[model samples]
Target: MKGRIVGVVLAAGASRRFGARDKLAARISGRAMVQAPARALSGLGLSRRAAITRTPRQPHALRGTGTALWSVGHRRPQAASLRRAVRGARATGASHLLIVLGDMPGIGRAELRALLRHGGLHPAMATDGRSLAPPALIPRRIFGPLLRLRGDRGAGALLRRRPDLRRVPLGAGALRDVDRPEDLRPPRTG
Candidate 1:
């Protein structure tokens, strides 16, 4: 909580399962999917913020969100995008990196605050009690491992194997991410 933390949004996924349309561009509750996470990160006042996307041009939703947009090859692996973010953070002298998925509109300011509050200098990830995932906080010590990550995988597998990883419990619904069209639908009310 005391060090310079850089917030990064990983938005370069191929969205192969979400039909021909771009999942991150899809809207939920009147806002673009990617905008939610980007906006959330912007509100935290991190030392720096960026979004890694597959498009060279900045998306309209992210234009005024205060997150610098970096592009990667659409076919590139998830690790490639992560490496880019890590390098940017390192260049900026950040002490920690907050990794958030652009497709996950469910994770908002509250969930992120909890992760940082409990994370401190240790690697911390959000959990729904059954599985570990991001919006994760990675201290500078683990940036090496993150740079070595390969093929479609982010820090999930690496964090899982770390004994020092802190699991911040969040509501299951808060971890929901958009993969398919139906995933954008609001849950039914009783």
Candidate 2:
């Protein structure tokens, strides 16, 4: 796991749509909403993992194993989250960064590995082209775009402006983010 890419979880949202409570701490089945992404990223063994929260508040339950990563605090805006995330990870020798959302519980470890592998060749965004978005694989060279990203929607436009980038479609999970109480519930199998 030497020199593997860093995985960044963007958990710094206002959670306004989620109503009360820090959505990052909201539980899904047995895990907090934010825990879902951390769980997936922790297994990657990339030597660095970081969660960008409104504060530097990382999941303490997730701490202990040195393999787990740092939590960075930000006082404003989602764009600040990405900028801080990339900068912090870069300080620790991250060659590339794989950004995952705090709300997509369905995104599995296998898919993340695939995303990282595919990301090595292309700077890609995860989407099914409907609603959920912002997850992606970003090269250090593209740090400018990440820093430039602003507003509530996050980095989607940054990817679009870069015509040289390639995108990988990871299906619904890539696009599925939890913004409401209904989002935490499992889909009906029917």
The global C-alpha lDDT for each of the candidates, from Candidate 1 onward, is 0.89, 0.68
Against the hidden reference, what TM-scores do the models get? 0.96, 0.83
Q: Give the total clashing residue pairs for model 2.
A: 0
Model 2 per-residue lDDT at 109: 76
Tens digit per residue, CA lDDT, model 1, 1-190 = 6889999999988989999987888989888899889988966769999999888899787877889987886799989999989998999999999999998898889999998897776999999999997899999989999999988788888999999999999987789888899998886667
Clashing pairs in 1: none
Residue 99 of candidate 2: its Cα lDDT? 86
Instruction: Summarize candidate 2's per-residue lDDT along 103-152 as a digit string, tens digits.
Output: 77777677677667666645776656554255677777787667766654
